[model samples]
Target: MAAKRILIIDDEADVREIAKVSLEITKNWDVATAASGEEGVTLASTYHPDAILLDVMMPKVDGLATLVKLNENINTCKIPVILLTATIRLATQPAYVEAGAKAVLIKPFDPALLGGQIESVLGW
Candidate 1:
């Protein structure tokens, strides 16, 4: 099978790097990362990744806003997005799903299990 391509969008440099390495090492997937929502959106359109790991908090364009832009764009709407965030109240999961995220993953996740979490979310 062709290696799955994933894009990770996070404001924290360490978060981005950790996720990137975790996916690449554990799943042998092709991973690209962006430090901000704007760059993430642009990459999503052009890179056309199979999935996106999006951080819920960002400076200018937060995850919710970024998800809206992605859903609004023809090129990126179909790619499933999984929200990577610090724990939110469980009640908000449905809200995030309604906003277009496939799943909500808590931050500080175990690096070794990141790909599996994504696979479960995306049904890969």
Candidate 2:
């Protein structure tokens, strides 16, 4: 079977690199990184990844807004998205899910277990 692909959308270069390394090396999955929401949309559209790890806060376009835009496009709507945020309040989880996030992950996460966590969320 072909390898599963994941798109990571985050402003922090280090976080994206860490995630890419973990997912690619440990999970043996194809990984793509985007620095902004617009770039994320473009990459995701082109890559058609199995899942997306999106940061909640960004300069040009925030994660929620970006997710809505992603869902607006039929080609990208079916892809699962997980929100990566430092501040995940009780009130926001439901809203994020309502906004189309499959899961919410706190920042400063364990890079070692990150792929496993994503697999658990994806029920893989």
User: Which is the leading candidate under lDDT?
Assistant: 1
Per-residue lDDT tens digits of candidate 2, residues 46-114? 899999999999998999999999999988999999999998899889889998899999998898899
lDDT of 1 by residue, 1-124 (tens): 9999999999999999999999999999999999999999999999999999999989999999999999999999999999999968888788799999998899899999999999997889
Model 1's alpha-carbon lDDT is 0.94
Q: Model 1 segments beyond 4 Å from truth?
A: none
- What is the Å distance of residue 58 in model 2 from its true position? 0.7
The residue pairs that clash in candidate 1, if any, are none
lDDT per prediction?
0.94, 0.94
Model 2, residue 78: what's the lDDT?
96
Superposing every Cα of model 2 onto the true structure, what RMSD results?
A: 0.7
